[model samples]
Target chain A: MLLQQQLDGKITEQKDTGTPLLQVRNLKKYFPITSPFGRLKGHVKAVESVNFDLYEKGTLGLVGESGCGKSTTGRSILRLIEPTEGSVNYRGKDLLQLNQREFKGFRKEMQMVFQDPHSSLNPKKRIGELIEEPMEIHKIGTKADRMERAMDLLKRTGIREDQYFRFPHEFSGGQRQRIGIARALAVDPAIIVLDEPVSALDVSIQSQVLNLLEEIQDEFKLAYLFISHDLSVVRHIADEIGVMYLGHMVEKAPTDDLFANPLHPYTKALLSAIPIPDRKQRRERIIIKGDVPSPIDPPSGCVFHTRCPFAMEQCKSIKPEMLQQSDGHQVACHLYN
Target chain B: MEGYPLLEVKELRTRFSSEKGTITAVDGVTFKVDYGETLGVVGESGCGKSVTAESIMRLLNEKSTRYDGEINFKGVNLLSLPEKKMLDIRGNEISMIFQDAMTSLNPVFTIGDQIAESIIVHQNLGKKEAMEKAVEMLRLTGIPSPEKRVHEYPHEISGGMRQRVMIAMALSCQPSLLIADEPTTALDVTIQAQILEVINDLKEELNMGVIMITHDLGVVAEVCTRVAVMYLGQVIEESDVDALFASPRHPYTRGLLKSIPTITGDRSQKLHTIQGVVPALDNVPKGCRFAPRCPYATDKCMTEFPLLETLENGQKIRCWHHQEIMEREAASDVITAAT
Candidate 1:
């Protein structure tokens, strides 16, 4: 099949289906801790009831501190790790219900670009083979056709054709990342989960990579789950932003609105904490007290209540449900409730 | 000592002999940190910021790493100092906190033992007295329940807590000069803010000259009194924090500032980025180091190395075409006005 025909197939397929590209509802992934003696310890509620919708060509940015289940959410959505329970409605198909054999079919449409370019790619394989292997496994094209598309992907990702024969170690960090992006784009995925794609690169290279991602997004019309701890970086690309705390989606809103008027205490704290380059901005920073409670034994009621300044008696007992405000801005906090 | 700076590096060069070859990582970099002020040394990775700090501390093995030029501490040239004297200066007068809290700290030792070890070694206090002092130092760093935290190992504590412990250890001996090399990089934003505040408070209280080495311009603007922007192991630009942010002379400085994604900027706006990556240390470019990546590179910039020249506002710039750049900007503005 021709590249143009494959692209048109996607267009027709999207047109045929009225449902959102990906609809994740009440996604819960829990990991049970076991002692050395095989005794049941506690359950780490890594992702507790994560709900969000991703449209075609839209980018949803997940922002949180380290170990806040932002990365876990992306992995669970891709089913890279087994999500304990949830309905991952990928274009009307419930992805979570599918077994390993069945999930393999959906794997082509949902791809991932990892953080470290150096370690992500298999060292033994040539760069060309790395990109070609995915399509070869999916049986999308013939050997010659797959090779051609891989080279095309290399060119589209701004990598030289000659470098495709080179090993991963030969290229610079930025160039290696381009190869990673090229590999992710090889399958013509509908949505890509980019986990800290630009964090490992330098500031100059970060912008370059970010610009490339934006251009690619425009050209391919693909949705992106841009997961990063950098709020500023996320603000630049993300349309909708979700602030994760412990294991819950504390706040969800449009990027501009969230940055402008953050309702949840955690969201407000997160926004205020970002160090603006301009000293003259003089924004008052809200430093939350203590570390995030261990996921194996998370705090009761509101997980953020221990660190939250406005925590009251109600917050310490009853968990605050996500209250929908005007214009799809939802915040889960007792203060808002 | 009347007019002397607290710490000053004059034409400092650091070279490491590896299997490949002897590569000059930090080439003739010079800067000064005065008493009770923080001098922010800002640069990207491989720009020799950390190497410069390490050179000042004499942390590199003298066998493999060769140092040229002078490192003056309290009006005394430390290059001539013997290993015995240098050992005394390491934690007593000069202290460094590195980037990674996870690896920099010993996982086996309790937090109290580590902090107290530094105290006992430098201050000559008994283990019992040093242990008490360790708790005091932890408390000063704003660690909640220092008594409990002191008993925990490096792994038991969080990243932010480990960093706090590192700072407490660095400050235990009342070091006049603190070289914090990316202290907040491994931490979250809120924790970074906290760490910066703690450093600021301690700097003021002790009146210690701080050499804050970081890649973050935001941290520089917040904490530093003066800033030195380095590229490929040389100080390309040096100005007061206000002046550096207000009017960055070097193209690299401007590019870096613009490259930083800010929440204040228009969403999804394409950031201004320098064309190329930092060259490998072994493959350092001749002439102006930034010529390859610089947009303003001319024949002169490519051929001849630009000397660090102090400008009218006491801002230092190392660019052959900075004057021409200003003139061009003026001309372009006039042209736009005429239109």
Candidate 2:
């Protein structure tokens, strides 16, 4: 369906083809390190020149280690943390240029679900009121309408109505996470940035939450930027996967292609590092030596050259640009060149 | 005594009296660990995996915690040992490495000093000789430049390095038995792989009987010789790592295995789930603890508890309908293979 908009007092019909729900380009977030006296020492480049396009009703998974800046990329897109440099284009609009009052309108279109559900949900408020509070903040509906919507959302997310009046402390970890999902859906967001949504849950509960997320994605046609450190969980839910290392997007590809033929050496090592549960299928693992380097002073060219198995002389002096290998496969490595 | 296992825990029942009431955290847990063998105790949260490890060490508060079981180390009953003698056996003979390496290590002391202190206390070594042994242990764990790294404090090193240091300290005195409780849980995937490799190499070198307590089945499959699956406060199934993965008898074990999203698993298929949450300790069910979540639970399962029975294959299963479940599963496997 073409959306008709009144732009400059004239009606214009815009086609939805080739328009991504969200586009992040050259995203860079650098936290300045300072001494106790407030003198700027240096900058810890958390995220550098990361780019991706998230289409509507699609899930893009971002996988990385602890300091690889996957969570920073997700938060920067939602403006939860201001980017040092980059543009977040939401449906052809630059969300970064918008002021607080103007950005409030787009906030309703995008919501975030934090990693720890225990700290994310308020302990004092009843579960029902917590879900309705988001709608109340956005001024979307009346008190009774919000209550009705909240109750409906709770039931849809597999929570019983009898527990609506209970506090967050009374619920289990899985149930609290379900309540978090219910609250995120309260604002009717089109794109939800889920940062390690099920990482804290047990295996059985993690699967239940994953199934619930898939069902809601189909029913509401929502897009997700699923950020997690678990590759298996990401492979099951995400359509496309992006691997990041030391604040750079080393590779991005369709889930099937990435798993079948990973291009980057880091990606290969990460895939092999996962301990397969089956005893008969122990693949030869490429164990990367040494820990990740400090982001404050990342390697001169490629941040991964410090521990990369196939690092060349050129890899130490010149950074490899992300090159498209196939239709939807991209890799940043000198081997491809 | 010469032919006895390195460590054997018999009917290990651990209870704690809290403000609410008394709760049996680890009930009737029995297992044996032999030299050069790693026994993995896998379970979900609140399943008494950690408590079992702590009870073996007698680390819990003696005032509130009560124990009624035989924890035999080298054919000696540890439960009857006095606190003074238990202190001598705590780290010298049986050492433990906790999940969080940061809190387990002393922050104020250098890693070398901490390692040396253990050696001096246990092996009757001088300060300089103990320091040399500490650096040697760090080098054995594959830490680069151990001479320099030994001077660094716990906070100065990275998480993976800290974990390696913890391993170095735990293995410094050449303990016969090692109890690692989720040692790599706080680490990243690649780092976890490295740590597991280090542990594997050290276990072979020392010929130590290792008890690995974790919730990750993948870790168990990688490093464990035998696996024991725990539910609530009991071991639901115990078998060799290969056998447990190939054909898990208990319904809870099957459900847990199916729930894990493996990289090689078909993405289109929905994951299998256990129906409900684990019952609280105070509100535990009267019969089988897993009956509420088990799909094959019958009326008999709700009122009667099943004993842990050993099969012909030497695998232990605690389920009344394991034979029926195995037969049905075999039939389904045949049908699927035919298709």
- TM-scores, all candidates, are 0.96, 0.97
Docking class of 1: medium
Best by lDDT: 2
RMSD of each candidate relative to the true structure: 3.6, 4.6
B57-89 in candidate 2: lDDT tens per residue? 999999999999899999999999999999899
Which residue pairs come into collision in candidate 2?
A: none
Off by over 4 Å in 1: A1-18, B1-3, B330-339
Worst 10 residues of 1 chain A by lDDT: A8-17
Angstrom error at residue B320, model 2 = 0.5
lDDT of 1 by residue, A43-75 (tens): 989999999888777788999988889999999
Q: Give the per-residue Cα lDDT of candidate 2 at B109.
A: 99
Model 2 Cα lDDT, one tens digit per residue, A1-337: 1112212111111123368889899999999999999999999999999999887767899999999999999999999999999999999999999999999999989999988989999999999999999899899889999989999999999999888899999999999999999999999999999999999988878989998997788678788999999999999988889999999999998888899999999999999999889998988989999999999999988889999999999999999999999977999999999
In the order shown, the candidates' DockQ scores are 0.54, 0.51
